[model samples]
Target: MWHTVVGAVGLVMGLLPHVLHHIGLLAGTAFVAGSGGTALFGALGLLASVPMLIRLYRRFGSWVAPAVGLLVFAAMFSLSAFVIGPAISGAEGDVTTPSPAPAVDHTDHPGH
Candidate 1:
């Protein structure tokens, strides 16, 4: 039971950086927005969850537990990227109305 809880916590921690980035929280950070900072943070989350994964593996004596972990990670990633992120960033309402385009000047100016 505790192993399941730990795994869930680890998944959330692991995906936090991505979620923050999606919500525009990491926009101003050069490292997090540009380089591989998000990936680094994600890897760290996975590393932190290593103990939980190990425990699951030992308890189940099979690879199924680890595979389930991977599936959960993927599901959470998708959920944040597609649903939660867009909703939080207001991207979902982007299609509601389009802004009017700026008028262009057709007059031609001659320079000597």
Candidate 2:
């Protein structure tokens, strides 16, 4: 059923980062490197869950329960990917590497 499928997807979305990391497919807190498949899937699930929720809403003529669960999952997913994960892995702020040192001016010193 759509409800079951959507619920499962929401669960996965909520745990995407930890799951991917645990499975060894991703290494960093930032978005998945290169293809970004896990992030992509989580994003897609967030988008797709809407219509499924609507369908469930129409079918049951009620909205609160399913909406709350899905919304919570989506929020958790977004927060984890965009905030918590980065903070946990120390990737939240910009990383500044010192610029290469300027070439020595030994010419002026003349090998002194």
Candidate 3:
């Protein structure tokens, strides 16, 4: 059973590199407005969940699988909200401080 779970994770991991590469390439090349941060974070979160998934599936039959996944995802997102919410507000606070822009030296050109 453990071997089967390990094998499945290995199979998924094998496919991950190709998929990740394509996702990154597509996002970088095509989507200038939206960065791939969400996808990257999601993939990382899913990868982290695999082992927990296997264990949950093993302990509880296929019926419980979906609920376990939902719970895990919920927990992950809750944590993300808790952590990311603060950083965002903190970043905004940082920009609130007035840092004056440096003077430009276009004096050499006789615009005056």
Q: Candidate 1, residues 54-97: lDDT per residue as tens digits?
A: 88899999989988987786677557556786787666643577
RMSD to true structure for each model, in Å:
7.7, 6.3, 8.5
If candidate 3 were superposed on the true structure by all CA atoms, what would the RMSD be? 8.5
Regions of model 3 farther than 4 Å from truth: 1-35, 78-83, 86-112
Estimate TM-scores for all models. Answer: 0.50, 0.40, 0.38
Question: Candidate 3 at 32: error in angstroms?
Answer: 14
- 106: Cα error in model 3, Å: 34
lDDT (C-alpha) at residue 81 in model 3: 46
lDDT of 3 at 14: 51
Off by over 4 Å in 1: 1-28, 34-37, 91-100, 103-112
- lDDT string, candidate 2, 27-85, tens digits: 55345542375468676766867776777788778878678869787888778667886
* Candidate 3 whole-model C-alpha lDDT, 0 to 1: 0.61
- Return whichever of 2 and 3 wins on lDDT: 2
The digit string of per-residue lDDT tens for model 3 on 1-112 reads: 9789777876775576345556676664343212254455456657667677877778886748857696878687656544674475454332366789999988798866
Best candidate (score: TM-score): 1
lDDT of each: 0.68, 0.68, 0.61
